[model samples]
Target: MRSCIWMGSEEKRMAPGQSGPKIRLAGFTKFEKKKSKPYSYSRTAKLLERFKNRMSERKDAFGPQVERLTVLHATVKKIADVERAKKHAVEQTEEVELVE
Candidate 1:
């Protein structure tokens, strides 16, 4: 039996009368071309800009109604809070009078 040791500076050789490993020559391989879609940044930007403009226009049309509803909601909440505070104050006064 022989040791299959290899050295960096030496070329590849085979043992007595044995065939060596086959070498592959460099060659270009044939490849299929794939069809792909091209992307455009300017078209995407224009679409986004158009969408924003439409959204702003729609918001403007309903802006006054939206403001009125918001104000109405705030007024109702304020009234509820005032009523709650008055009830809490009365409860505290009754507790103090009973203690005295």
Candidate 2:
């Protein structure tokens, strides 16, 4: 079997059971390959430094908020403990009265 692929003004053929599509490089089209630009080490370094600075600033900004949340958590836990103690005491008194 054979398949046809249209590229620009030419029709390329592909054989049966082929692993990949056959591309013809013998024609000129509207699309042309351009040379890739060179990499810049200084630009990459500046970007990385900026990213690190932002991360540190975020940590500093959230530090106080995190500490306040921790303090609130401890306070809630202490209140829960007191409530549990009161509940236990009430249950114990009910049990003693039933025994008597």
**Best by TM-score, which number?**
2
Residue-level lDDT of model 2, residues 74-97, one tens digit each, is: 565566667668889999999999
Highest lDDT scorer: 2
Please give the range of 10 consecutive residues that has the lowest summed lDDT in model 2: 39-48
lDDT of 1 by residue, 1-100 (tens): 3224356877555686665554444672544488877534344444545554555577767676556555554565566567668889999999999999
Q: In candidate 1, how many Å is residue 62 off?
A: 4.1
**Cα error of candidate 1 at position 47, Å:** 38
Residue 36, model 1: lDDT of 72
Per-prediction TM-score to the true structure, in the order listed: 0.37, 0.39
At residue 78, candidate 1 shows an lDDT of 64
